[model samples]
Target: MTVPIEDVRAAAELVALGLRTGARPTDANPYGRLLERYRSQTLFRDTVDTVASGLGLVVLGAPARTGLVLSTQPGSVFAVRMGDLRSTGMSADEKLIAGLVVLGVAAYAFPQEADLDSSEVKTVEVAALDKFVRDSIERVLAVPGDPESVDGQARTAAELYRRTAAFRPKDRQPGPAKGCTQFAVAEVLGWLVERGAARQMPQLGASTFQLTDRFRLLVADVAGGEALEAMKAVRAGQH
Candidate 1:
């Protein structure tokens, strides 16, 4: 299902807010507004289970591992993963990888991933994943918009991610993921990373991510009251 470009921009901006503030899914930060918006819209209700499974894969990476590398709370991996799969046909498996890519980007944005003390992620092919994520962001941008403004696109991406994460089950395992107890969010994240829409930093924590710079620039281009405010909040956090 295609969404308004402005909406996409708004959504991306919201995620960026979370990134800037180091806000976790469980945090009561302003990012919760994005979640509230999606819940009100009732988007991605049909295939929530699939998306959850995909996100679970992202938490574990391409190959299932003994433990997650990221330091997110128990349900966080699921939120990030599911958020990436919003509104896309990308299956549960595909989304799982996508969520992983989000985690990779998050790690890159922050310095927390380096602290993970796990051997499950020892190798990282950065160049390959970077290219994949860039291509995916471009495709996401290719969607037509009535206004074609930066705010349109940024909101869309942010809200999409927020809704995907919010709709995911908080506890129950949606399905088996690579021999692990995967959820829809993980499955969706896995799908995106594998499909080249996003990239993953496997050597980093499950919460890590690196959205293509192209996606970042697009997000930077948006200029809405709420979007700009969110950006300000992020910038303020950096200091």
Candidate 2:
């Protein structure tokens, strides 16, 4: 039997609320009053999942990794891979390289890849990866492309580098980065937090974030097989 349109609208609202607020629908609280009325957790979850999938995302726990998807759009906060990072003057080549640099750092530092959830990652390892990522980004940006503009390429890389600082936790109060070569890896880590994939831990002169269970579950499907290899190749470009 077909479901009523009202039910669909309510479900959509619930999905938005749950993702934005990170509240699971439950029978007791008003959080999921509709789901409670229906008396079905599976129904509510599946409905939310369906909505997320339609938007090229997958809702994990409420408010966590709220809308994690690899795709980028016109103005997605997820990454710079989407439309022009700025209004204009940025070349397609710059966009592609900058995106790859960000993507590489994210993939390598992924809890699934680095397994930060189960083990403590050495600070040296984190620093090394950051170096590799910055070098890779600069290399790609520096490489001459069709109708290349050296000054434009350098400027793009510099902008990306500056934006990298945008990721440092406001609380940590990190000082200014020396230059575009800096990782500002914190940005990727912040992205992880936004996606509910990881949570920040106490720092001892170094940064670390604990991976969440949902991260493991989601990556198992999206970060394995061919997708994993492709991600690896993207990261390898930095090497």
Top lDDT hit: 2
Per-residue lDDT tens digits for candidate 2, residues 1-239, read 46567766766776555444244445455555754533355665566566656655545333222222223223444323324334444455445445444444445545245553443432223355455555444444444434235334443554465355432323455632422323334444555556655666667435556555544544443433332334455455544
TM-score against truth, every candidate: 0.25, 0.47
lDDT of 1 by residue, 20-75 (tens): 32332332544455544534555432122223344342111111111111113346
Give candidate 1 misplaced runs (Cα > 4 Å). Answer: 1-197
User: What's the C-alpha lDDT at position 175 in model 2?
Assistant: 34
RMSD of 2: 8.1
Instruction: Report how far residue 175 has shifted in candidate 2, in Å.
Output: 3.8
Clashes within 3 Å, all models in order: 76, 4
Candidates' C-alpha lDDT: 0.37, 0.46
